[model samples]
Target chain A: DVKVTQSSRYLVKRTGEKVFLECVQDMDHENMFWYRQDPGLGLRLIYFSYDVKMKEKGDIPEGYSVSREKKERFSLILESASTNQTSMYLCASIPSGLVTTYIYFGEGSWLTVV
Target chain B: AQSVAQPEDQVNVAEGNPLTVKCTYSVSGNPYLFWYVQYPNRGLQFLLKYITGDNLVKGSYGFEAEFNKSQTSFHLKKPSALVSDSALYFCAVRPQSGGYNKLIFGAGTRLAVHP
Candidate 1:
C-alpha cells in the first residue's frame, strides 16, 4: 500500500518561533501538496510541488512556505508560528501522469501555538 | 471562481436507516467531482469519485454518490448508517482545464449516527 508519512504528529511552539512539519511519501509521485484543516474551512491548500526544487503557491500561501528538496520529502515551514496557525496540517501526493483519481494523504500533524 | 458547496453543516441519522449528504458544484468546463470522509483527528479518506461514464459511483465503506449533470450535484448516499460511519464529510472538485492537482473543497458536512 502507498504511504504518506508526516513526521510530527503533535507539537507545541511559542509565538514567533520557527516550525517545521516534514512529510514523506513512498509513492514516488511527482505531485505533492500541503494543506491546512480548520473546523469550517475544510482543507485549504497552502502549497504544492510538482518536482524536487519546484514549488507553487496555493490559495492560502500567505502565512506558510514549503520546500521540496527531494522527491519523497516535502516540508512545510512556518517562519514565525502564530496563534492563528494552530491547525491540523495534512500532506498529500498523487501520480501526475495518468488520470488517476487517488490522492494519498498522511495521517496529519497537529500544531498548537502558544 | 470554481467551487463546490455542501449545503448542510450537519446531518443526523439513526442506525440502520438510510442517510444522505448533499453537495453541489459550479465550475467551468468539465468537472471531476469527489467525496471524502475524515474521522476525528485523522486525514481525509477518499470515498468516491466521478470522472466519467457511470453517474452512480460506488466507493469505500459502503458509500456511493450519484453525479447529476443537470443539477450539477453529487450527493453521497448509504443504504444503512452505522455508528462507526459518523465522520466529517467533504465534497471537492477538480477543474479539467488546468492544474492537475488543484482541488477546490467545500465547507464540510458532519454526519452523526445514533445507535
Candidate 2:
C-alpha cells in the first residue's frame, strides 16, 4: 500500500503571509503534484515535479511555488498568501514509467487565509 | 489541450438503485480517462480509468465506467447505490502523447445516496 502524507491537515494565515504545505510519499514515485480544491472549481493543478530539483507549472500556478529538494518530499509554497488562496491543497504521486498508473493522493491540507 | 466535462452538478438516488455519473472528454491524441471520488475534506481517490481495450472497465468499490469513443464519453456506473457511496466525483483526462503526466479535471459531480 502506498502512503502519501501531508504534514499539516489544517492551517490559518493572515493576508500577505507566507505559507508552506509539506507532502511526503513513501512509494518514491518520480512524479509529484500539487493541486488546490475549491467549491465548484474541482481540483486544479498548482505545480508538479517529475524529478528531484525539477518543477513545472500547472494550470493555476500563480502566487504559488514548489520545492522538490528530495525525491520523497515535495513542498508547496505561497509567496504571499491571500484570501483567494484559501482552499484544500492536495499532493499526489505516481510511479515513473507507468503511463496507465493512477495518482495516489494525500489526505490534503486545508488552508484558510484570512 | 486536454479537458474533461462532468455534465451533472448533483445526482440523487435511493439505496439499492442504480446510479450513473456522466462524463465527456476532449484531447488531441489518445486519451487516458479516469474517475475519482472525494469525501468531505479529503483528497480525490482513484476509482476507475479507461486507457484502451475493453470499453467497460471495472474499478474499486463495485464501480465501473464505460468508454464510448463515438460519443467521447466515459460514464461511471454502479449496480446498486449505497449511502456510503455518496461523495464528490470528478472526471479527468490526460493525453497519452509523450506521457505528459498532467491530468485535466472537470468541475465534478456530487452524489447523494439516501437510505
Candidate 3:
C-alpha cells in the first residue's frame, strides 16, 4: 500500500506569518502536487512538481510556493499567511506522467489563519 | 476548456437502498475518468477509474462507476448504501493526449445515508 504523509494534520497560524506544510510519499513518484480545497470552489491546484527542483504553477498559485529538493518530499510555503488562506491543503502524487495513472493523497493539513 | 461537473450538490438515500452520484465531464478526445471519496477532515480516496476496456469499473468499499462515452458521464454507484458510505464524492478527468497533464476535479457531491 502507498502512503502519503503530511507533516501536520492541523495548524493554527496568525495573519502575516510564514507557514510551511510538508508532504512525503513512501514510493518514488515523479509527480507531486499541492492543492487547496474550499467549499463550492473545490480543489484548486497551487503547485506541482514533476521532478526535483522543477515546479509549475497551477490554477491558483498566488501567495504560495513549493519546494522539491528530494524525490520523496514536497513542501508548500506561504510567504505571508492571511485569514483567507485558511483552508485544507492536500498533497498528492502519481507514480509517473501516465495520463491513466491515479493519484495517492495524504491525510491533509487544515490551516487556520486568524 | 476541459471540465468535470457533478450536477447534484447533495444526495440522500436510506440505508440498504441503491445510491448513485452523478458526474459528467467535457473534454477533448478520450478522457480518463475517476471517482474519489473524501471523509471529513481527510484527503480524497480513489474509488475507481475508467481508462478503457470495460465501462463498468469496481473500486474500493464496494463502489462502482459506469463510463458512458456518448453521454460523457462516469457516475459512481453502489448496490447497497450504508450509513458509513456517506461522504463527499468528487469526479475527476484527465485528457489522454496532453503532455504532463493535470487532473481536473468537480465541486463534489455530499452523500447522506440514513438507516
Candidate 4:
C-alpha cells in the first residue's frame, strides 16, 4: 500500500505571511505534484517535481513555489499568502519510468489566508 | 493539447441499481485515460485506467469503467450502487507519446445515491 501524508489538515495564515505545506510519500516515487482545489474550478496544478532538487511550474504556479530537497519529501511554499490563495492544497506522488504509473494523493491541507 | 470532458454535472441513482458517470476525451495520440474518485474533504483516489488491450477495467470499491475507442468515452459503472459510493468523480487523459505526460482532468461529475 502507498501512503502519502500531509503536514497539516488545516492552516490559517494572515495576508502577506509565508506558508509552507509539506508532503511525504512512503512509496519512494520520483514524481511529486502540488495542486490547489477550489469549488467549480476543480483541481489546478501548482507545481511538480520529477526528481530530487528539480521542480517545474504547473498551470497555476504564480503565487506558489515547490522544493524537492530529498526523494521522499516535497514542500510547497507560498512566499506571501493572500486571500485568493486560500484553497485546499493536495500532494501527489507517482513512480518513475512506469508509463502507466498511478498517482497517489495525500489527505490534503485546507489553508485559509485572512 | 489533451482534454477530458465529463458532460454531466451530477447523476442520481437508487441503491442497488446500476449507475454511470459519463466521461469523454480528446487527445492527439493514443490516450492514457484514468478515473479518480474524491470523497468530501478527501484527496482524489485512483479508480482505474485504460492503457491498452482491455476495454473493461475493474477497480477499487466495486467500481468499473469501460473504454470505448469508437465513441471516445470511458464511462464509469457499478452493477449495484451503494450509498457510500457517492462522490465526485474525475476523468483525466494524457497523450501517450508526449514527453511530459501531464494529465488534463475534466470538471468532474457528482454522483448521488439514494436509499
What lDDT does the true structure give each of the candidates? 0.92, 0.92, 0.92, 0.89
Worst-scoring 10-residue span by lDDT in model 2 chain A: A37-46
- Residues forming the 10-long window of minimal summed lDDT in candidate 3 chain A: A94-103
Judged by TM-score, which candidate is best? 1
Candidate 4 docking: what grade? medium
- Tell how far residue A113 is off in model 1, in angstroms: 0.7
Q: Which stretches of candidate 1 lie over 4 Å from their true place?
A: none
Q: Candidate 3 on B46-104: residue-level lDDT in tens?
A: 98999999999999999999999999999999999999999999999988876444588
How close to the true structure is residue B44 of candidate 4, measured as C-alpha lDDT?
A: 93
Better of 1 and 4 by DockQ: 1
What's each prediction's TM-score? 0.98, 0.97, 0.97, 0.96
State the local distance difference test value for candidate 4. Answer: 0.89
Q: Could you list the iRMS of every candidate?
A: 1.2, 1.2, 1.0, 1.4
Clashing pairs in 2: none
The reply for model 4, stretches above 4 Å from the true place, is B99-101
True contacts kept of 2: 0.72
Say which prediction, candidate 2 or candidate 4, comes out ahead on TM-score: 2
Tell me the TM-score of candidate 4's A chain: 0.97
List clashing residue pairs in candidate 4: none
Native contacts retained per candidate?
Answer: 0.60, 0.72, 0.68, 0.50
Q: Candidate 2: TM-score?
A: 0.97
